[model samples]
Target: MARFQTPLRYPGGKQRLAPFITEILEHNDAVGWGYAEPYAGGAGIAIELLLGGTVDHIYLNDSSRHIYAFWKAILTDTEAFCRRVSRASLTLDSWQKHREVVRHPGDHDILDLGFSTFFLNRCNRSGILTAGVIGGLNQVGRWRIDARFPRNELIKRIETIATKKRRITVTNLDAEAFMRDRVNKLPPSTLTYCDPPYYARAKRLYLNVYTPDDHVRLAKFIQSKLRRAWLVSYDSHAAISELYRKRRQFQYSIQYSAIQAYEGTECFIFSDSLKIPRDSALPYIAQALRQPA
Candidate 1:
């Protein structure tokens, strides 16, 4: 089916980062790498790559069990899960009904049930993982099912299906573990798009206790392991800006809001410690980096 039939409703999702992703992929002619997004949420980027046929292999991961479960269901029981989703009326009453329909079915993996539960997640007033579980817990807690199905233009797009032939793997792992441990197991040419938790806003929703130190560690890790792998990261603090600036990397600044609060600039870095691909135009910030600051 279409790599994704629904738009994910998470703060700082790579939905807006799609354009930059295309640019970077195009610039590097990075159309054949094994794609990995350890922080996969809503599978936005992974699905995009699937549709564009950018990568021959895909690996998606999200620490959030709710998200991981949703993916499991879609991949394994696509038709049945879609049927359940389509039959359910998109009202609050229907929400409970659908929840009950899929709730106790042990034939499928809990991850599958979790994937089927995201329909309500996108519209929940709090926009957190509170719904679709038993007792409302934070990201760590179980999910409770509630909320309406997708509607309007976006949902219509999601209903379209496209088949993918590439090998695809999904998991629930911390981003660094996937990069540090998993990358070594892959072929020499693989691409890792890390939409890690935003350093500024939306950090709490992403990780139980993400701190500034985590961001520094992540950057250091990326730089160290980037010799053979290509990576794309979105971060915009001065420290982030300065860290890569020192490495002679290209960084693009874009503005977007998170959690309905508009603030800060998101800086995207294009790095592949390999020789810069010479085919495409230089990245936007390449020339800017040549100049002072």
Candidate 2:
């Protein structure tokens, strides 16, 4: 099956981990259930599941107001959003202008905010607004615009994502609160997939960073959901291990960098009720390690 492309690029996205997630969902018969993502950066896994017909409904939430605004804009007025994004130029000056708007949105309309977020994310380095100019441009260097930011392709992607508006529920809320509001109300077959900011690099990479205390709170929240099946993806860290030590854990290596062969060990902590096959998790480590930078 062809993969559904995400409208925005995100750091630590779960594209590579979708296979294992699919396996887990299939094994637990959770594919028919409504899906929820409390920290849906780019909504990679959620979109994958929706496209694959693994899930009928999805509830996507993000803590960042900018991201939430972008999502809302897309789902509400896809044509206008895509039109604005299509007109965005790939230039340093344009990037700077959009960056200004994103940094201090002030009274700007949602379309402006959404387009600014989209342009800055697509043109900026590593899809990070604060990361400055786009990196890894080969001989062209940072100043030169890369062809990767294709206009028509992006519009097409936006249209494709817009088609699923009826099946998705986008919200702007804190992860814990979002969970508390929906965990009990969702069907018994429902599954929650969480890809929160990693404890080790949360502060450095994300605007809405989570602290050690937040991790503790998340651990407790997941533990409290006794009837719902949930899965969390996070980097392997001592603090994280200790917090989720009681849950079933599976480790896999992921290559997050396209310009460099950067790899990190991430753990998938599953609720007690869920089961992940050994074969689904082990082979990916070798494949990720062997991938070219």
Give the TM-score (vs. native) of candidate 1.
0.72
Query: What is the clash tally of candidate 1?
Result: 14
* Candidate 1 C-alpha lDDT tens digits along 1-293: 43344456665566554544556666667777777887887667777766666767778887765676776655665565556555545455655543553445454466445644565555343345433332232323343333334344343443432235236687877778877778657886777777777666554455343577887788888887654555556656777776566554444544444435654445556564534433223344444445443
| Candidate 2 segments exceeding 4 Å error | 1-4, 135-143, 225-227, 258-260, 285-293
Candidate 1 — worst ten consecutive residues by lDDT sum? 132-141
Off by over 4 Å in 1: 1-6, 89-112, 130-148, 151-162, 203-209, 242-245, 249-264, 272-293
Instruction: Tell me model 2's lDDT, rounded to 2 decimals.
Output: 0.77
| Candidate 2 positional error at 24, Å | 1.0
lDDT digits (tens) for residues 1-293 of candidate 2? 33547778887777766666787788777676798999988888888887778888889999887888788888898998888767766766777788888998666777788788888777766677676666533426544444457788888878887899999898888988888886657787789888888888666567778878888988988887535788888998878888988887756676776334478888778888887554555377545434432
- Give each prediction's root-mean-square deviation over alpha carbons: 6.5, 4.0
